[model samples]
Target chain A: MKHNFGAGPCILPQEVFKQASHGVLNFNNTGLSILEISHRAPEFVAVMDEAISLVKELLNVPEGYSVLFLQGGASLQFAMTAYNLLPEDKKAVFLETGVWAKKAFAEANLIGNAEVIASSKDKNYSYIPKDYTVNADSAYFHCTSNNTIYGTQMHSFPQTPVGKVCDMSSDIFSRVINVADFDLIYAGAQKNIGPAGATVVIVKDEILGKSGRKIPSMLDYQKQIDAVSMYNTPPVFSVYTAMLNLRWLKAKGGVAEIEKENNEKAKALYAEIDRNPLFKGTAAVEDRSKMSVCFVMENPDLEKPFLKFAEEKGCVGIKGHRSVGGFRASLYNALPITSVHALVEAMQEFAEKNV
Target chain B: MKHNFGAGPCILPQEVFKQASHGVLNFNNTGLSILEISHRAPEFVAVMDEAISLVKELLNVPEGYSVLFLQGGASLQFAMTAYNLLPEDKKAVFLETGVWAKKAFAEANLIGNAEVIASSKDKNYSYIPKDYTVNADSAYFHCTSNNTIYGTQMHSFPQTPVGKVCDMSSDIFSRVINVADFDLIYAGAQKNIGPAGATVVIVKDEILGKSGRKIPSMLDYQKQIDAVSMYNTPPVFSVYTAMLNLRWLKAKGGVAEIEKENNEKAKALYAEIDRNPLFKGTAAVEDRSKMSVCFVMENPDLEKPFLKFAEEKGCVGIKGHRSVGGFRASLYNALPITSVHALVEAMQEFAEKNV
Candidate 1:
């Protein structure tokens, strides 16, 4: 058994993978390849509808919110959210926690007025920014809930008077959050949902159409919501695979149980990083990510050897983001505690040998 | 052994489906699911490179052109093309053949100046508009090669001095076209290529960057081309499946051989439709699409019973689009001639029973 620790598109339940494979070959015993079936067919429609409804049910989304499964990933959403929400006169507020947050801010700037309310760039984004003030007149207060590169997560949400928009790309569904806390939440499904093709958007219905600019039909949130995410032929196979993942998520006791197990895995790994003399955690202790556990070797010389050692121990995708070097052990919801234990054991062995 | 005639997200080669399904379960014997692998992984990178190369080879894309696999389907491309190509002062010309064409024109109108130079809407889009002037000052002359809903197609080309753009979503690889004739070509990979999650774009490198507006980063052609379609995590599974289909296409004697087969399939079905006393072809004779062949019953009362009988006889997804309110038999590239013969037999038996 190999341990997968890469950030997004990292790990998923084997059951989900199996079911999705079955779907691709013979969807519902229809003898028609799922890849060949129409997206508007009753079966595909059911898949789309069930996927959307399960998202709502899993999140316990409030009634006023609309859930959308869209293409172009969260990167498309970075521009779409700003284009649809930011008006000409009103500026958007952003909290820059890491690389993705900075990119999100830049995308918003491209569309219209956007201001970085706070940033942790000075300290290399090792922690979430805590002192940002949200402008009452701003279109929305945008923030990245989890920094995938730096391995820091926002444990406390900022109390914003204006609309709150969160890019929960890496940490969505790993933990439960109050659905009413944010005006909008977007996540790239490759992380915690299913695959790379689908993006999930949870938007409060009232927050849209205020922007005066004519939105591209595909980028319009209201248009997608009105059509119930079938505004066009949706990414069918991706959505179907995502539905299988969602079914798996629900079967495993939903987000609350998964969140508990997630903490256990993270705690075991972080405990090892803290105790081992040869390694150190990268993120600030208080803001360490429960999802992606970033760390580095205390003796820089041992880095390559430790990585090779880990690879020999059946650990895969443990390398950190190129922007931030060393190692990153992403403990997503589907990554079992046994994998974390295995990684921890490898780390301990490496430290004992090196130090 | 089912006959699939749905317009899009339609038939794909059975071999492609099998290989893709296997990849989903165990990609390249890595012991990790394809859905869980990183987009930047060497395996996935190979998948991307091979897919791009195959698309280039299949289309005979010139050296100066870039082939991009993008998300958001053709609907997004409708806006992206105009946003990238249409300058602020110069108008774009469009041939409005059907519903999709009208929508494409409207998307361009939202971005900049767009003129519908010709339209077949006067005749319920039963025929392709032939008489159209491509103004010399226009930025580009846009056309849809095949009208999926209205069952019409352009049998002749308008040789414009300006840039030429075509959305070949429904009938791209069914026939051979001179790649040099168009500045850009785009197709949603559902019908003729692969599944519904990916779109293929072939753009001449010289036609971009003329528009003054700051194109949305995701929609910017230059950025996408520069990044080699890896600017973000693409729809990995979709693109991989599409690559498998492309390989299948190449293995089946490429576009030239497929075109002959497609014509034969279309001819057989159209002949049956024309000869049946209960049926009548919907599209004009010269403009009928070889990919999507639509027909209606001469006796309207027989429509429901005929459809029911066809469905019972191992025919699946043959329903007509709601807008056209008639049976549509889409014979895309991967649709076997046997399926066409089955459909023809169904129509003949139904005609004998009813008439």
Candidate 2:
């Protein structure tokens, strides 16, 4: 079996793939491919409903929030969060951690007054900024919960009086979080949810429709909620397969259980990075992502060799982002502990060879 | 044996379904699911490239135009087209044909000065409005190439002085069109492309980046082209499956061949609708859609029975849109003429019983 560690649009449970594959052929034995099923049809509607429900059940989503399945990925969410929540007069505050967080701020800045209160850019986003205070008069406090590129994650969110909006695109649903902690949480479904096309937004009902800007209906959170995510035809197969993935997540005892498993996987790989003589962890130890484990070889020259060495051992997609050149093994919810073990063994073997 | 006539997120070739299903489990023998592959991966990049190439090849899109596969169905395009193309000062005129046309106008109107220059709404949008001259000074002239709800297709586009934009969501690949005639053509891929998640836009490069509004990156067509539809992660499975569907279209001798089959399918059904004493065509006779064929029983009371009768004969998704109140058998490119024959046979058998 190939160990897929390619970051977001990464691995899901094997069963989800099998189940989703079956759906593309014959969804629920309707004798119609999920690819062909009408979004308005009862069967597909049920899939959308259940997918939303699974999100609620899995996350213990609070009642005051609206859950949405939308398109255009987290990049669109960056613009939408600003359009739907940031007001004309008030400035939006951001703790810029990485590229995604910066993009989130940039979009908001384009629409209205938005400023970065804290940034880790000087250190190449190796650590999450911890000492930023969101202005009480701000429109919202925006942050990226996990930085997929740098492998840094906000272990705890900054407490803010203003609305809290977080782009949890890389690490959502990998662990449990209190749903009431943030006013808005948007995640690209490519990571932990299901696939690339659908993005999930959990927005507190009260925070939307407050932006004075005339938002497009597609970008308006309130409109999407009112239509119950059917404002337009949702990404059908993406949502359907996402439902199957969520169902699998639910069956695996939801976020808490998955979180525990995730902890073990991250722990195993990070331990090897620390213990192995040839490798070193890249992110700030405290802020290192549980989902995307980033690391580098002690000698830069050995990086390519290790990557090739690891791939030969079936530990693929371990090549790190060019910005942080070495390796990144994304231990998403579906990536098994066995894959982690395999990666750890590769690291150990590579270290011995290099020595 | 199932005849899927459901409107978009509608039917695709059965072989496309099988290939897509196989890709889901193990894409290209890469030991990675298509659902899991990174959009940045060379494998998926090739899929995206081939998809764009196939669109150009099939449609004979000119060199100056960029073909983009994007997310957020046509509804998003309703907003995006206006946001991208309509300038702050000039009015965008429209020939409103159906509900979709009205929506396209509404979204454009929200962004700037957009008005309906002509409309077929007075006749319940049963015909395409023919006698309208677009102002040379207008920002753009927009039209819906095919009105899915009312079962009307534009047999000939209006010769316009301004930039011509068309939403060909229902009838894009079903007919041959001179691509050079329109400045931009956008279609939600659900109908004739592949699935619900992706929307296709063939846009002239010169027309974009002139709106003078600070368009959001996701909504900005120029930004999308600069990034080549990889501005963000596109719907991976949708684009891949669309590529497969397009490959199938090319294999079946491309759009020219499909249009002939589409014509024959429409002819057989419309003829039966006219000949059967219990039924009547809903759209204006000359403006009938080759893709979506809507018809009603002469006795409204017999509608329910006829629907059941057709479904029993495996002519599923034939129920008409609520606005039309009859039956709509969408004969998309992938829908075989055999399925159309089966639907016609069911209609004939039902007519015999009613008599």
Q: Count the backbone clashes (under 3 Å) in each candidate.
A: 0, 0
Provide DockQ values for all models, in the order shown: 0.83, 0.86
True contacts kept of 1: 0.80
lDDT per residue as tens, model 1, A1-355: 8888878687988888888888888999988777877777788899999999999999999999999999998889999998899999999988988888988999999999999989999999998878767878898999999888899999979778887899999999999998799999999999889988899999999888889988999999999999989889899988998888898999999999999999999999999999888889999999999998899988778889999999999888899887778999999988999999889999988877865
Q: Number of the top candidate by DockQ?
A: 2
| Candidate 1: tens digits of C-alpha lDDT, residues B1-355 | 7887878788888888888889988999998888889999899999999999998898888889999999988899999999899989999999999888888999999989999999988888999888778989999999999998878888768889898999999988888888889999998989888888899999999888888889888999999999899889999999999889899999999999999999899999999988887889888999998888888887777788888999988776677777777788888888899999898999888877776
- Provide candidate 2's TM-score on chain A: 0.99
Chain A TM-score, each candidate:
0.99, 0.99
Query: Model 1 segments beyond 4 Å from truth?
Result: none
Error of 1 at B308 (Å): 1.1
